[model samples]
Every structure is written in C-alpha cells, then in structure tokens.
Target: MEQLLDEFRSTMDIPWSIWSARLVGTVVLCGLIGFEREVDKRQAGIRTHILVGLASALYCIVMQHLVVSDEFATDRVRTDPIRVVEAVTQGVAFLAAGLVVFHQGNVRGLKTGATMWLSAAIGLACGLGLWGLAVTTTIIAIVIIVLFRKIEQKAGTHVPGHKNAGEKEA
Candidate 1:
C-alpha cells in the first residue's frame, strides 16, 4: 500500500508544465532525427526513435523523484544520479546495437545505430531540463544526417572499411 502511494506521488512530484515540456521537447527533437531516418528508409525510424527518447527521459524524471523520497533520502542510501544515466546508456546501447550489422566485410546500419544512441542522449538531456543542450544537439545531428550524407554522396567520399560512394559492391 505504501509502495503504491509512493509511485502515485512520484508521478505528481514534478509540475505539469515542466513534465509536459520535457516530454514534448523530447518528442519534437527525437522526431526530427527520426524523420531523417525515415526518409532514408532506415530500419529504426520515427516511432522507434520517439519511444527511445521518451523512455530515456522518463527514467531520469522518475529517478529524480525517487531520489528525494524517504526510501532514498536517507544519507545511508548515498544516491548518485549518475547511475541512472549509466543504466539508460546501457539500455539504449543494447537497442542501438541491434540495428547494426556486419556482413561481407562491410558494416551497415552504422548511422542508424549512432542516431538511436543520440536519441537516448537527447532524451536524457531533455528529461534533465537541459533544453538548450538538447536542442543544439538535435540541430547538429540533423545537419550531419541530412547535409553531410548529401555531401558524401556527391563527393564519393571514402569511409574506412567500406567502398567509396560510387564503387560497385563485389
């Protein structure tokens, strides 16, 4: 009974405006990155990215509340928020790794994997209420995903362990 009540209170710990802002901001930022992936027809598209972002943010938000609760408030608990981040990182990395593949001496889905990783990062930043960092990171990611890809294609740029843009697969 007390545990149930604690969960309810944790949900309400943060004000509506702040909570909504963090979630919505995460959606918009992650959405942009996901949109690019979708346009590229990547396996991990908008929905995957958005969900990843929200999950990451929720982890931090919930941790913030629990950290202040009596269960964790005791000095003996010695709570450090970095653990939450590490947990999120490992979780996201597992998901992102699935999108990556190695076949025939060429790696694929590298960009999608990196994007998924970044989505979690953006989510964490938004959840921590670092809107500026989240927004800036999102913009930079978009530029790299969109503009840089175009440049690489047009220039036939070479990437390690992969053929140049114009090279035919063996």
Candidate 2:
C-alpha cells in the first residue's frame, strides 16, 4: 500500500493542494450559479453546471501544465495559449448546444445554454487562480439571472417558447 501510494503521488507534477483548490473553487462557484437555475427549474441545473465547470477547470490546468512543460523542454516547442482557450470555448459551445432545442418555430433553453457557457468561463478563471474574477463573474451571473428574470416578468419580455414578447407560437 505504501508503494502504491508513492507511485500515485509520483505521477502528479503539481502539488495536490493547488489542484484541490482549483477543483473545489470551480465547483463552489459553478454550484452557486447552478442554484439559480435550479430555482427557476432550468433543464441544466446544479449537476450539469458543476460538471461543466469542473471539467473546464481540469482542461485549463492541464493546458497550463503542458505549456510550462514545453517552456522547460530541451527542444523548444511553441505553445499558443489562444489555441488552448479556443479549444475550450469550442468544447463549451458543444456542451451548450446540447442544451438548446428548436421546436415548432420556437427556441428553448437559450438561457440555460448561456448559463453553461458562463459556468465554463468561471471554471477557467478559477483554474487560472483568478479568484476575484471567478467570484465577480458568479455574482454577476446571479444578478443577471435573478434581476433579469424579475425585469422580464414585469416587462413581459421573456415569454416561454417564444422569440419575443410579440411573437406567438405557430
């Protein structure tokens, strides 16, 4: 058991504490955003947001590690951070697409899809150790969801299964 534990520990280059912080922070921030969705009964609620945020954070961490490894290599290897971020964005876009549905001339789940995208961003921020950015983003997201919901209700702008206030289902 000692040897097994040693071998497992040897596989990780970064400290466990750093990884734990990133993962836990991502989960907590994303979970808060997810809670708003849960209250509103959105399809992609807590679990989905948490999973997306966690996975995105893991991806960011791996990408950062890969860049650092390349930086210290004997043979120089180019590492483009933009490409890594673009890949992450594409992945999150795919996940968000899964939540969207078009039916009977109406689109559904737009807000939920946007929420998932925001969750990914929050995860990336946490992974990069930008605690302030992550926290601020989460708070802004909650405000947008809650405040906009109220505004929509008062303005009658956010109609279910409809494009706009004046658009009727066909």
Candidate 3:
C-alpha cells in the first residue's frame, strides 16, 4: 500500500505540499466568491460557483502536467494554455445562459452571470499557479459585490428610469 502511494505521489511530478496548498487555496478563494453570490440570492450561488471554480482549476492543473510530461518525453506537445481559458469561458457562457431570466420586461441575473464568468477566470488563474493574483482578485470581487452594491442602489435612485413614476423626466 505504501509503495503504491509513493509511486502515485511521485508520478504527479509536483511536490505534494505545494499541490495541496494550491488546491486548498483555490477552494477557499472559490468559496469566498461563492459566498458573496449566495448573499445576493443568485441562482448559481455558493455550491455552483465553488464547483465551477474548482473544476476549472483542476482541469488547468491536469493539462499543464500533461503538457510538461509530453515535453519531457520529447513528444509533440502544444503548450497553449489559452485554449483552457477559451474552453472555460465557453462552458461558463452556457452556465450563465441558464441563470438569465426574461420576465416583466426586465432582465435579471446579468450581473450574476458576469460574476460567474469572473469566478471561472479566477479559477484559471489559480490553476495556472497564479495564487497571489487569484487571491487578490477574489478579494476585490467580494468587495465589489458587497460594498459596491449598496453604492449602486443609492446611485440608481437618481437615474431617470429608476425613480418613482411621479418623478419628472427631461
């Protein structure tokens, strides 16, 4: 059993500690962003966001490892990380489409859909070993979702369409 474990660990080609740290950090960052979405009561809230982010990060890590291995074995390996980003963006678009609702002549969930897109980007950053950027971006996203929301509400009241029906229009 120990031999199998050792072999498996060695085959990964990355330090176990670093891999674990990256995984945990990615998960936590995803959860933080998800939590903010949950507070907003969006359709794709905590679990959905976290799952998407984690899966994106995992896919990136696996692709990177495969690319590196192919290079070491002198095989024809194309190292195009942007492909992963493109794929993730496409997939997130599908997810975002589901979150959109057209009713009462109003469009809802657009911001939530955008948030989902951003979350996937953060996951990609984490997957590409950009832990600091991912963490920083996640923090910024949280602030935008939480703090900026209040400011937007207050500011929106002054906008023509957002005012009460009695308000005069220019």
> Considering every candidate listed, which one attains the maximal lDDT?
1
Task: Tally clashing residue pairs in candidate 3.
Answer: 0
Instruction: Provide backbone clash counts, one per model.
Output: 0, 0, 0
Please provide, for model 2 over 31-128, each residue's C-alpha lDDT reduced to its tens digit, 9 standing for 90 to 100: 99888888777778899999999988888788778776734554667767677667778998998998788876667888889999999999988887
Whole-model Cα lDDT of every candidate shown, in order? 0.85, 0.83, 0.76
Which order, best to worst by lDDT?
1, 2, 3
* Candidate number with the higher TM-score (1 or 3): 1
Q: Report the number of backbone clashes for model 1.
A: 0
After superposition, which runs of candidate 1 have C-alpha atoms over 4 Å from their true positions? 1-11, 156-170
Candidate 3's residue-wise lDDT over 1-170, tens digit each? Answer: 99999876666666567666666777888888778778766667778877888878877887777777744556454577678888999999899888777755756677778888887888888877898899899888888777777786677632222323235666
Clash pairs detected, candidate 1: none
**13-130 in candidate 1: lDDT tens per residue?**
6888998899999999999999888877778889999999999999989888777767677767787899999998999899888878886666788888899999999999999999
RMSD of 1: 3.9
Error of 3 at 85 (Å): 1.4
Return the lDDT, model 2, position 88: 74
